[model samples]
Target: MSSISAHGLGGADDLPISGSLAIVGGTAALAISFVVLLLAWRQPRFGRAGHELAVPPPIARVLDGSWFRAGLRVMGIAFLAFMLWPALLGRNDLANPLLGVTYAWLWVGLVPLSLLFGPALRAMSPVRTLAELLDKGTGRSGGEGVVPYPAALGYWPAAIGLLTFVWLELISPSSTDVGVVRLWFAFYLAAMLLGWAVFGTTWIGRADPFEVYSTLVGRLSLWSRSASGRLVLVSPLRNLSRLRPEPGLVAVVAVLLGSTAYDSWSSSATWIRYVQSNEVDVTRLGTALMVVIILVVGTTFAVASMTTAVDTRRSARKELPRRLAHSLVPIIVGYMIAHYLTFLVEYGQQTLIQMSDPVGSGANLFGTADMEVNYWLSQNPTVLASIKVLAIVVGHVLGVMAAHDRAISLLPRRHHVVGQLALLAAMVGYTFMGLYLLFGS
Candidate 1:
């Protein structure tokens, strides 16, 4: 199998913006936004659960209808079938649709899909659909399995799953090999099904890497459900504030941010030269570096979060990181868009074209084989760079606002502003680093 670039795009030199200018401007935007938030946003404005505008009845009914949900499941099943065709029978080369579908469409395309529509993957997960079907076939309620899901496992399995996936996509030398990709999916399907059989549908929520990632990003979307199970529209920030602090939450966010950052860093000329010159195994070194980057991100955020003086009677200092972890979702989404925009837009179309002839037999089953990918985004480097910087800056600004609101709600009034200093600094640091990677890499 031929290798494919994980991010199908040109290098930083192709970008029209000056690296130093973008970095400094992005950093200044974050700092200024933080100061503005500190002054203008004094009160705790979010974290009000059930605060949302009710959707129109017709729209709500359509969204909540059984038929609508079943249609989504059907689409999910069809999508899975389409993907499997390439994985199971297609060429073991980059021409296979499976490679682009797995890396670009599903991985990067998920961000925008979830952002526009809430938790699209969860609604469309073939594994969950199959598990549900199995439960029904056995006269089970789909909630209770052989054993209850352990609350302490909260997102830990998903964290590990996500880390493993990124390692394969970003570090593994054979990531594009059709055999390897097929095995990876086989293992994922087996593990998810087993987990569901043992712990019920809850396993999919807490353990499925793609589902968990999508759900987290979905929290930043305007779509949400109310306490009464009605579909409602809510401010993304307020919706994010409702995210419950759970075990392994910090680790999940860390893996996401760190993996994306590492993706950018690994693509740089500096890293490439180092890898070429060293006699060390590239896979081993890449894995180690990815892990270290993840650790550093988690550790720094945890430390920054707990540096504030907290009211011991109300909130435990140790739990602050997890409680505040929701704020990072915006940043993660922003970085994902900036990092994967070109790849998703360009390669996603290519994947669609490839899907038309999954087995390379010249069959136009999907009628897209004759279509060509539009490289508008890549062709306009200035527009692309502007979007990247804007996404990163806007995400950081929203994150700052979210963090401030959480801080005011949690910290003593006397120490509110002071309490957020370290966290703000850390956020600024993250923004700077992210921009540098975008520009430098």
Candidate 2:
């Protein structure tokens, strides 16, 4: 029950498994994914057709009502107010709810919320709501930017923003400090508002890191608004095709996968011992390691996706990564769940308890401050380890399916089997790397 081990809650000390077990797990992860190449639907089912389930008329009315949206926005702002208060004026101590709220709840908690509800952050974004309010207050005309957002920039800003946010989470010594959180949010809010002003609202869509991330994961959510303005319930695979191809899309995914990988790496004893023994400043070294990991992940995928040795359209080599970028979402989200599930469940409770005493006045405004977090999951490493492995395998399977769909659509027919080699290798490497981090390190 110590924060000394992991990022979000008490450390994760996984029950050690034998080398043979790890090797078997890694091979199974690859075998399961590679199975997609043999039996994958060749016609691109997801890209062409989505299996939608009808919503009953009465239920649809409630879900699509204007009041529901407004209520969510109001709730988002209220939570924003709660966290902002502690960040600004509350005690700059662990008793302050800011640490738990930011790390445990907001970042890690966004995964499940998005998976179940779809773009939960955007629906409840205080910044998005505030931006809307600011624009309306000024009575804008058409809301076009003075300078149209460049087509070339795409989500690269979001990619950079993601890296910056994760940098704060991963490397900074003052990460949990109230002043640090305040300053970080201060810069974030100011930049968001100012960017919206000059570039119009497209700036926020392109540059808003958290929103982009939430929306990315939202693709896996069962509930989504279809083209005809109806809320449709669909399978996650059916919903996967909805991700629009955009510039920097691949890079954005690369950052997500690589950063999550490094976050796990940092918790390993290998990383811990190296940082402690090194003469170089730990912060700088940590930053380097993060950057390196991100680059390595991006490079691996890019090479694998582009290196297919087939006679095909000239642009296929260039566009392959972007075309298949959606495959990484499942993997990133899966790893996120694997890495932070215990942290979120345990520390999320801790956050709720802390929120009741936001000002550190010892007053339990919600009358639930006396709650004790269940640490049983943390103690039962065997069950936890099984869940983590299963999650990684599931993610790999999903990634393979997504990639297979894209490959059939994009690659030439003759190259389909042979062409998937690089991609399959990449998925196997990525999956095994995750397992290795979980088991070996």
Candidate 3:
């Protein structure tokens, strides 16, 4: 129940029950899914159904290993290094610059493409690679047409991670401790590998909790689309119909803010000087507000990106408006730019301020980051942060533009040329602006 102990206490004797339960549940789910899938594969009924499934043409397979695969590997390794060695390896805090960039691009741009083209992350998903390893190592295959349960239980791993993160922040906040976090990540990596044994590659594809929750929303609303088909962004409401900001995300943000608030409130000196130095308390309030804002904005961005990707994938028609056609890539890039801009603007200040005055004014901002942000900031400050932020922006733009181009090409020849040029020009202008703020200032 205690947050600190939730992730197995520093003392080997203190094991977290919640964490153990998650691992157990996840393992059980994978086992069941694997068994069922194996049975189906070996069974005549499943075998018959499997033969009826459509197969992709050879040409469609060639595009599988494009930039997406490379990008995923690069990001995964970068994240691994950053997480495993936050103190000596990565950005200013646990905020790995490369990972940040990837995240920005992925959510903004690649997600849309994945929806339109295919499962974007599958190409180089570390999870998938590990799953393949499991399949090969275990000598298991869908020989009879059984479903892959470990792959089916993909969400559990992420769920465990997310839950563990929130608990650490709110209940027993130890993410600030570098050694502890690394140990936790060790467990996380181990658990993820275990998950692969059940799910296989694209495990999350079969069971994304976000998508599942969205389906519920899709069915309830009068304006909701059938959960069966792809979503269209032509209408904003319809495009976003299934997206709901979950309370859990809010709770995560609340815990972060509340922890900071508790720190300030519990400090005798802080409260004593409250009336005399109102500005100090106000600053703490600002910090608290910032935490909540990050949670809300970050969660929203994540939801939007995932939903967009899913819808794009489901839709058979890839048509788009002349302006919006090539807009997907640029939109994602723009999102990355925006995402990093804020991160740089925030983290840069946090690091610099903390360094100059460790315990004076705003030290806690840098000092108290959970493993994710703290590790990156501590490891690589300016270079990683700047690059990551820039990458996110640039990646989003490229992805959006690429998607739009694909959509535009679907139009008549004359329309494609003119439309591409116009979109490119707009993207250039946006890029220029981003550059100016990033460097010109």
Candidate 4:
């Protein structure tokens, strides 16, 4: 099988702004935001601030109706079948829709979907639907299994699952091969099903990577559930602050941020030349480097979160990282948009076209076989670069605010401003590195 080409609009030379300017601007934005937040925003104002607006009864009724939910579940299953036709029997070349669907639509497209809608995958997971059906057939409760889920497990399983997916996506030799992609999903489905049988629907929320990812990103969305289980619109910051700190939350965010960074780095000329010059196996080396990058990201954030002076009696230093992990969601979403915007726009269209002929029979079943992918984003490199920079800066600012609120709430009154200095520095470093990778790569 031919290697899949890296996706991007253009090289660093093609960017309108100089790399130095972008990095400096991004760093300045982060520093300024930190200072403004430190001085102007002294009190903790999220999580329990009650900024939510109840949805109208008519809209809420439709949204929470059983029929609507069932339709979504059916749609999810039908879409799964549509993609499986190509993965299981279509041509083994790039023409296959499987590769594009997996990489472009499902992976990259999920971010925006989650941001617009709340935990889209959790609402329409085919695996969860199937589990529920099986449980009903067995005369058992929908989310109940043979045993209760252990609280100690937390999000560790989801973190490991996410790491495995990134490894397959970024380092596997046959990542785009039809058979390999099919096999990977097969194992994923089997594991999810088996886990559901053992631990019930709770397993899906805690172990399914895509669901966990969507849930994390969905915190930024306006849609949220109220205390009475009704859907309501709330401030994104408040919704984000409601994320409960759990074990391995830091690791999950680390894998997301680190893998994206490695994706940018691996596409750079430096990494490509290094791989070509050495006699080492590219897969093994890439895998090791990816793991190291993830570890470094997690370690840096963990150390930074714990570096501040805190009253040990009030807040445990070791738990600070997980508590602050919600801030990284915005950063991850920002980098994802920067890295995958063109890819999603271009390849996503291409995938739609290919889906019209899933079996390679030259059938335009969906009348999209002849559609051409528009390269508008790629054609305008400067505009694309500007959007990327803006996204990074805005995300950095939001993250700064989130961190500041959490830090102040966790620390003593006197240490509020001082306790955030280390975290602020770490966030600045992240922004600088993100800009560097964006422009340099």
Q: Give the residue spans of candidate 2 off by over 4 A.
A: 1-20, 141-143, 309-316
Per-residue lDDT for 1-441 in model 3, tens only?
011111110111122233233233333443343334333323222111112212243532443345645667677556445434333444433333322222233222343344443334544455545555567677877411134554323234443454454344333334445445546546655665554444444444333322222232222222222333322122221222223333233232223223322322323243446546665554445445445543543343333223223124533222122113222323333333333333443444333333322323323444443222233332343444344334534443443334333433244444433433443443343333333322222
Query: What 10-residue stretch in candidate 3 is worst by lDDT?
Result: 1-10
Q: Flag clash pairs in model 4.
A: none
Write the number of the candidate with greater lDDT, choosing between 2 and 3: 2
Residues 1-441, model 2: lDDT tens digits: 235125432223453566347646765766765665567566777866547886788999987789988999999988887676777779987777787777877788888989998988988899888878877888875656678888888899899888888888888988767788788878888888888888888888888898899889999999877778788898887687778878888889988889888888888788878878878787888899889988988888888888663645667577778778889999998898888888788877877888888888888889879998888887887778777877877888898888888777767787788888888988888988887776667
Q: Enumerate residue pairs that collide in model 1.
A: none
TM-score of every model? 0.96, 0.94, 0.33, 0.97
How much is the lDDT of residue 395 in candidate 3?
41
Rate residue 58 of model 3 by lDDT: 51
What stretches of model 4 exceed 4 Å from their correct place? 1-4, 313-315
TM-score: the better of candidates 3 and 4: 4
Residue-level lDDT of model 1, residues 8-93, one tens digit each, is: 43445555767787888889998898888878887887866656899999998998899999999999999898777788889998
Q: Candidate 4: deviation at residue 88, Å?
A: 1.4
The weakest ten consecutive residues by lDDT in model 1 span 1-10
Candidate 2 clashing pairs, residues 3+ apart or interchain: none
